[model samples]
Target chain A: MPLPRRLVLTAALAFPALARARDTIPPEARPVPARLLPVPGTVSPELQRLIAAPYPVGWNVTPTDAAGWRQVQVASSAAIEPHMAALAASLRVRVEPSSIAGVPVFIVTPETLPAANRDRLLLHLHGGGYVLYPGLVGVGEAMLMASHGGFSCVSVDYRMPPDHPFPAALNDAIAVWRALTAERDPRRMAIFGSSAGGGLTLATLLRARQDDLPFPAAIAPGTPWCDLTDAGDSLRANAYVDNVLVAPTGWLGGAARLYAAERDLADPLISPIFGDFTGFPPAILTSGTRDLLLSDTVRAHRKLRRAGVTAALQVFEGQSHAQFISPGVPETAEAFGEIAGFLGRHLA
Target chain B: MPLPRRLVLTAALAFPALARARDTIPPEARPVPARLLPVPGTVSPELQRLIAAPYPVGWNVTPTDAAGWRQVQVASSAAIEPHMAALAASLRVRVEPSSIAGVPVFIVTPETLPAANRDRLLLHLHGGGYVLYPGLVGVGEAMLMASHGGFSCVSVDYRMPPDHPFPAALNDAIAVWRALTAERDPRRMAIFGSSAGGGLTLATLLRARQDDLPFPAAIAPGTPWCDLTDAGDSLRANAYVDNVLVAPTGWLGGAARLYAAERDLADPLISPIFGDFTGFPPAILTSGTRDLLLSDTVRAHRKLRRAGVTAALQVFEGQSHAQFISPGVPETAEAFGEIAGFLGRHLA
Candidate 1:
């Protein structure tokens, strides 16, 4: 069961998360602030409330093995079930289970789609650190975007670990993308997602570029997990400052390992930040001052811009990871508005 | 010598540095690390050396009054004189003292200016928290840009505080801008600066927009102090973390008061972030992860983009305020290269 010497070195390089120093930890060891801080009055009351909330107790929970991951996934699906009906009803978005190229997806349609966006379709990749939020649970963000952006969506319920890992989710995403782009005019389509979904979105484009497939009109990868390895500064600087992903060594790192499996984490599809962004579509990235992936999102935007692609980035005042997905918040509305507007400009 | 009630209220609003909470202070209260951290190996050795250096001993030194500020100015000039000669010599840039429309300026020309940039000129405004670097001392950055960017620069030696405050600096910048634009095609010109100089650059554009004058083709405002008021989140979030401007209540706030005099800090002419960015030229902004003015730079970029202007923003990893200006650093080269490329794209 022992790994070969070369494999060990590659594994070491792949999971540098273990080798990362605790330098991001504030030398003065004070407890993380429990209050809305740095700048409180500047943000909305709703955001203030959201910012003050502590990290979920089990945020860093790690499953012992494949079976444990399945249990966590099932539990997550169940927990998210109750909110599904309510969110769909309030947002006036209908989520229909569907399949594209044999890949499971949730076709999210706004009750009142704008005539302007009638021909527009957004490919959605739902976020859950590549392990959680499978099935209908992953459709929440897609639903929100559909409702707010007034565009129909195909939310990929991509395969995840415990059952299928590494190329499974990306394969599902590519399959859906390939199927959709085949029938639809790629100019009228865009790919969008948050966190892992965001990572998948970029990976999809990188694959499309590699396959010489026509690129989507645009992309919105919100606080993407662009780099799987512990390569970014914010991973440390925003460590405990980001309440959502409290630290890099927590569940996120474990999820990354579970997802990558035996593959090298630096593989472009695994960590798209290492991928070349040349000839990629215009992108609008979102993160927050307090987001753990702020560095990932900004770095990706910089890379894209450096590649001569127009990339717009918006960092919310006090938001943590994917806090813009919180419904009824002004910041959420603004974030979605920016994304929708940016996508609209590029899409036919 | 008691101030009037109205003045006191305005002063309170103008200088909220005292009222700011210490929420950004890491709860653990660990001493700031002396080593390069968070992501040590990510940056160049030059940047690592620069970032690890502690804040200048008198970075927060507050002059008691007009005479004290004058004394500080003289000291700053003397100290900077040595670097001026060395930098100019090394950069292969010729700095000539000149006057534009009665305003003192430094015409920084490269030893070998590229033929393509013969007609292109960059109007530079030097950064010194609006109270330091005066006369020829303010032209070092201009020299770097001239040599590295292959563009001639006219660095405005704008009037400063104690004797000439508030409108005087803005007036000098505007006067020079008007005089230059009157002769040169506005399309061939760009305005660029860092920190307080950046604030002035934005204010000048806002003024031009107000007066129905033409705007420069492009701008590069590096880590601008866009808001004179304590309105930004980074002012608190990056407090002691930004070694350059360690805290909001230091000499920065004092300088703000000295610059504004009796003016409201929220005035668009003072805090240009408060100004409308409609019809502005393309802009490129730069900042650092650890910059106190990071929020300022990002906020300005957002505002400009929101106003339908083409704005590109580049934030360096693990850097403090204006560290991009450090000569012989890869980051410095990268930052200037981005600005130069962006400006070239916009300029004739």
Candidate 2:
């Protein structure tokens, strides 16, 4: 079945949720020729290779329930489990399984912490479209930040659906945040993540405001899935052009539905793009030309700036949905560098 | 002939300037299927209709010389000329032919100017790939701004290539800006345009700085063709996806070549993306998800922000190059509204 238009106006509309008419799509939506793309010379050789590479394994799986999601999660976790030790050793970071406020987490500490960031701490949220990555497999981004940005990190292992949906993940995030803020100075802390993790980063802030919690010094939300209602221009414009998340209809659409469950997709908690960003701390957003969530990140940046918060946005040459985090791509290093630089300037 | 890779590293390198190997194109480039695109529900009915409409007349023309370009320019100018009076009358703006510093211009004034902007003025530069819109026909955007933004505007009818090239347009822009500042406060002035006009807006600022002139309070450079070298990622990534400009191999590449003539493409004056943006005034940029110049506009906003200048970027849903300027589209009004609001806050 084709992906249905998800932005329903009301509950009583009885819109055809599963029906997609042939003439409904925009006529301008046509195939893009690869040769017509920016030549290989535009981006670094490493990114060029990655851009030309095939999509990651199992990018199109549409798991139905918790059992099915767990099965896919285990396979993905095991695939990265072997490389975790080597990756940590190379970065000279120590990763220990831990828990914060009873929420499972990973404590990542660099071997030689720079004096400048000694009092600073980063709360990391791993992104897997709110599902895929679990346990140690999700600590890669945290490890990268610890190693490259010279900061101690806590990687949030938030709960996901089809068992724990909506507020469960948000609940775990706020719980950890509350615990961290109670112990550490909010002025010396920051939060960062990519994709679903990025979405949670913003939602956490919205929740923090409601709880009257002091906000962190800054944030880095890279290509956030902040609008889960699938209401951004790139959701349609970048469909197949974005090789990684080739189309919203694939796994992503299923994941959003599975995760949101019965909750309103436009609820600010589920989609932070709809949340008020007033008085939010300085933010640095990252995305690529071909990312499926480019519009989400751009909208979040605009919202932050509109609310009078200082915000910076960096868009890499030609990347698709978190491709900046690809193993050793130069774009990955640059993306992290820009985020770290922004956070460093804001953190006390 | 196909658009050659325009970003040549050096003049002495004996590269195959005219040859393009079929294998050189990325294998991923294939014809996009319209059915897989975002459904028609994403944008306004007016914009959807425009998006669904066929490309504008003469969109694919590639004139060879001065005479050829002149013929094309006349046809385009004549086509738009018939509507100028009606558009101005409906917009409630008076258009008067005038000259500043001996350079031809169209002075646009809203009949009911808001008291706040009585002394403020906007310098307009119209876009036509640097060779299309000329004379009174180029004042459409100025009229829109005068009527909608409630500000007096001076639309620079700058000279274009095939007759005048390189610094001629930039020269005229700076001359008018200097003349305007001589009599009025620079703090109350803003400059704007789309496409080539957008490019000229940035270039004008760079030139003004060199002449040790006071800067305007703000600027709106929408979908600027800021990089004549064709160095941006969108020039390739948005190739066929951008319906209006289709591909870099089209008339745009030819126009860039004709305008730049013998100058270095990467010279900061020619490509403001390479210019320093330090101390630049607040700027609000506009582009669409599918604009061929989206990357250029994105890059300029980053540059301005990095230099500590406030910048806002609005990427409309499903817009192509300058489609935000399409008459009667809600997106166009929104795009102009964002720019006008941003400028209003900054201007004295």
Candidate 3:
């Protein structure tokens, strides 16, 4: 009746069939699926592509000067607002346009909220390997995060790789931060992101420190791609077990090369694990055991702690990378709840 | 019917009486009842005195001599085996004596277990604040970890602090590890500890790296005091909120100083957060949000990650430090389950 026992019984029954199937397929070809992966009914095609990509290579390869890159970035940005508008309508949150460092930004606040009911502002960067899935694609996830976490969220559509490259995304994040400091109190702020966005979150903090900018009260980098080099053992060891990513050589590693094109891979600005983390704020990082970037999250967490930064790392079992975006999953919801509690403790 | 909701309602009803009792006691005079402390029933007289004393003043306080430290360590070692023996008796596991680097070690193996069964081993260190509660006091916990994890646990009765200070505990752990390398394979091994033992877990890895020893598959540092300087903000911020360890200044801080004695507090062996973590294994660090050393766990996790180490951190809500010893508590059981699950994944 229970899951594990049921699984055991079912596995016993299917052992012979599984063995036959294994014999028919070559080990090297076993990991690749033959059919078109079905998108969850609730997810958009754009998001599906973003999530389904072997690695976020497309984002890194879009040429900065190319017309196609410009069109894709524009299309991506345009695609996001409609999704967010739908989410805002459902959640009853007031979504307003604002400028941070002259860049257009959207501030989503709970409607009719009073000063006593003030919540922390989360500056979020959406994950798409820095090339795709702008703020719009994250509307559902953002709404879920805000409602569950009881915070206002501002999702940024930073410049993507290929065109903008290493510092472009980092620069945009800092500009928006400076704008927030000019208009809002830094004490009421936290930063969060997943995948490439997660890496960007850490990069932003490092940039803020170097530029003498105010740090957010807390940060959450979920399955961050902190090391562009993909030198961690998991990148090799977990290559097949993790179903989401294609493989480091084919996807993530390629994306890294494109993102870091002419930049140094060890530049702390590009790979925050190498940054001087002297004055960063408190942070919480989440990852899964099967994630290729699990090592990156661990490395970043240790670096921050060594620098006297308050930080926590949470790793979920039996999960793939950035599974947090799939809010319908039990693990995703629990992970969000943990983030909410961590933020409440620090931000309160 | 649901337990959490019922408990919340019950707590709400009892709030007024609790407030009244709090008002009757002065803030400084408020004493946490013994029942709320970890392993309250087992607090020895010497441990009480050590915990109650104000910070030792001036240098050359004639710290515990080598013989005195060894005597206390041995006594504490003897104290823990009874509980372990009781657990092994209940689980029908065979307890055997073994020597590791001339130090006596206890191994708990499940009875009638097949040779083909997974060969998982937990190398556990006991908590004592580096001063008290050595090997003997931790048998119950060690046994529980071993049983629940479905593995043979080799618990080391490593030397304590004061007389044995700094590298002494670290060295002893490495020696046990060396002995283990000859006895077992590294692929299915894990290291775990609590409090001072937790610190030793991290310290051991540092020593192992410097000495070119094989790394364990995974590690669990439960409420580890990773920072010898006691400089984490939580020491001051959560001082009163934390029910265990009456005062950080006299309790943990003083204990750390006395344990390290004349050794440099910043030495990587003394404070693992300062170590180069390039060659270490994956780790899982646990703590309660209310624990004074919660920040230490967080910081240590971050440092390990930044050095490209795979690490996971889990913080239990509403828990005191090292609550893992209290297996009756649901949170404790859940924490152990998580540790076991993590170990299973990495070790399998």
Worst 10 residues of 1 chain B by lDDT: B7-16
RMSD of each: 11.8, 10.0, 23.1
CAPRI-style grade of the A/B interface in model 3: incorrect
Comparing 1 and 3 on lDDT, the stronger one:
1
Pairs of residues clashing in candidate 2: A29-B34, A30-B32, A31-B31, A31-B32, A31-B33, A32-B32, A33-B29, A34-B29, A38-B236
Q: Candidate 3: lDDT of B3? A: 15
All candidates: DockQ: 0.09, 0.15, 0.02
- Residue-level lDDT of model 2, residues A210-257, one tens digit each, is 999999999998789998997887887777667677778777888898
Q: Which segments of model 1 are wrong by more than 4 Å?
A: A1-36, A71-79, A209-212, B1-39, B74-79, B112-116, B210-212
B59 Cα displacement, candidate 3 (Å):
52
Model 3: fnat (fraction of native contacts): 0.02
Q: Per-residue CA lDDT of candidate 1, range B1-348, in tens? A: 221121111000111111112224323312222222443455776666555554444556676788767766676565456556767888899889999999999999999988889999999998887888787777867877887799999999999998888999999999999999999999999999989889999999989887777899999998888898887777766665665677786778889999999999899999999999888889989887767787798788878877888887787777777877876777777778878988999998
Rate residue B127 of model 3 by lDDT.
Answer: 71
Q: Which residue runs does candidate 3 get wrong by more than 4 Å? A: A1-92, A111-119, A138-141, B1-348
- Evaluated at residue B65, the lDDT of candidate 2 is 72
TM-score of candidate 1 against the unseen true structure = 0.85
| 1 or 3, greater by DockQ | 1
- Sorted on TM-score, best first, the list reads 1, 2, 3
